[model samples]
Target: MLSPLGVSYLGLDDEGFAHFLRGTGAPFASVGALTFLFALLSLGRWGLRVMLSQKHPYEPWLWDHSWRHELQDQRLTQLLVSWPVSLVLLAVLAVVHWLFYSRVFSQGHVLPGALLGLVLLGFDIIIFTRVLGPTVLGTLALLRFGRMRLLLPGVPLELGSRCQVHLEARSLARMSNVKVELRRIREWAETTGCGDERLTQSVTHIEHSHTYTVDAAALHEGKALALPLELPEGGPEHSTALHASRSCHWELKLSSEVSSVHLDTTFVLPVYYVVGGHPARAS
Candidate 1:
């Protein structure tokens, strides 16, 4: 029996109503609701950051510039473009699993070892597809755009000196609006929260940036792209410690606006400060 509010039990004794409240909804009402609300708020903040960054391409601080020294390729952006196809494939896989594989697994006729092997095979296929898909796409990109590599000068780059960087590539006449950026990134690991639930998070921020645009037509028939960047004297110098908890480093980011295949990659740059004819020491 329900009361006028439709929640109060009219027929239940005090103890019975207490038990119903404890088992069904009290925990969610008192604790889970607040946790869910906070999660939604955090998600909203992240979404806002993404939208703002996409809207303003020139602004680097609007986006999270996480530092990674790995060589980046066109496949990273291509993967974003392939998301729709991946999602459709995932939906079809889910349907097939629900309609056939789940029922087949429920039947006791198959041996446990064989069933385990089949599951393992499915996982292997998924992993192979993920690895191969990116490689195939990246290979096609390499064929179309050709190869490009950064050519740094033999002399070391100082904190406050102007440096000349070169990009060796072919068919620059076809590419348009080639851009280069020298970004200084500072990252550190911070421990948050109390003992048992302590969470260690690495935080990164772009401290200084120098952007330059190259005119593709200015390049001679078979000449490389020359990038001249002036480093700031006031900015923090590169840290000497490799495994320090906090450190700053420089990176060279290159991009182009082409019709079919565009070049986008980042390279680690070594920038040091000289003090008394010696490199500055890190504390």
Candidate 2:
């Protein structure tokens, strides 16, 4: 019923479709196997480099830390953590495929959908395990490296107590006129327990201290300024304790004369008890 050219075109399309389906298994298997093999080879190479470098001479000054070094450390750490999990997942997927194929063939029904689902699932797992998961975890780990201790107070304090937080900075000779802001975080009642009315009111309140300025010379020399935090007259009641914790966030904006460099760090403070004689247990 078809014209000669039309029939030839239809035949070509059918041939192409059949070839695709036939080679599907080969491509999937090859890609997965190759990816796993390449990852393994890369791991080996990095391991060898680390091992060989250990025996080589090193200099203390060369250990100067930067963002790139931090990033590499994070990548190695993530690879070590996630690679085993990915291998186990791959093995499980293989077992599942074998089981599905056996059962479906014995039942005399085609499980095209199951086969397709397995392929999709395998691809998703491989990509996520190898790429996305490692990238996210590495980024978070790197960000938390030097930044964590900067913001935490050096000393611990009981809840409801007040403490003074110090802010320090180093400026170059050409820098001047920097603005700084401090943010306070209030503790909240445990979500699981019945919401405490007094705790709610205490945390909802906002109290702020004055702002201070640092000269260019003082900043260049890395001098620090201190500000005292005031506590409420009475600590939190027996049922409610002062929810104020001693942590402050700082933001520095430099004038045009100075280079726009942003520095953030946490300061740790000793815990204090306000009206309440004792610290409230974490809920």
Candidate 3:
């Protein structure tokens, strides 16, 4: 005995109604699966772009350390990384969908599973787009607001050696009360607790700092005002070394009174020292 809205009202038997429904709606369900697949690939691409943003393949030095060559290399490698592996997860999802489809229609039940699959796919896409859209838009807005240039004697300043630093600034509008500074930072990570309870945390020490105030008149005249700094050797190479457990670093900072807002920019000084040799390599 068939029911109200389907084949039963028209006098078809239960098995014939089931066959008609499954065979007819199967095409639409397959299309939904394909849509979900496209959304998954798109979300993966965006995640790879964000994860690799911190990697600058064009760095003056260390450009090719572990395949930091093309942006796509990072994306492809991340796509293949273990744990929540994309292809594996996709295969698992496919298997689950097929099982649910068979269980629903083959067992003479059709009230929910097919529709739920489409709902789940749409929900995931909604969540992904919502999170990704704002983050990308805001980052682009910030980059649009400033143009910056910093000059350095070079990377890896020698211990107890004097080095010259130059910083130049230009803006679309007049900027005033500009200042520049060189700061030495010593940083390390410490692990506390034990076993499964263990946790790692960072430590930072402001070893020393020197500041230079720019003449307001120079900025107004508009010839790319140059601010210079002289730094003597502090010690140690950057923590970027693969074997390093601690890092010693320096930062060059710039701040200017722009309209009513203070604009600030900072650059890390990548200096290293050589034993019984020379100061940090020339910037």
Better of 1 and 3 by lDDT: 1
Task: Give candidate 2's whole-model lDDT.
Answer: 0.40
Ranking of models by TM-score: 1, 3, 2
Output the number of the lDDT-best candidate: 1
Q: Worst 10-residue stretch by lDDT in candidate 3?
A: 64-73
Per-prediction count of colliding residue pairs?
0, 26, 10
Over the stretch 1-283, how does candidate 1's per-residue lDDT look in tens digits? 3233222212333444344444445434535565677699979877876686577533322233322322334444555546544554454444444433343344432454355447756965884498546555566566665666666663335677887777666666667667888888888998899989999998988888889887765443667677787877742235322334677667788887566665676766656565654445433
Candidate 1 versus the native: TM-score? Answer: 0.53
Which stretches of candidate 2 lie above 4 Å from their native place? 1-165, 168-180, 186-217, 227-234, 237-258, 264-271, 275-283
List model 3 lDDT by residue over 1-283, tens digit each. 4444333332234664565456546555655686689799978765664455346322313321222211111222222232223333444455545655554566565655456567758754764465434334333423433445555555544445565554444443565566878787767798999999999999887777889787656545555555555656543353223223555556767666554445566666654445555332212
Candidate 3 regions with alpha-carbon error over 4 angstroms: 1-145, 153-163, 235-243, 274-283
125-207: candidate 2 lDDT, tens digit per residue:
87687765765555544343222212224322334345554434333455554443433334443334355643332233324
For each of the candidates, the C-alpha root-mean-square deviation to the true structure, in angstroms, is: 16.9, 17.0, 12.9
- Report lDDT (CA) for all predictions: 0.58, 0.40, 0.51
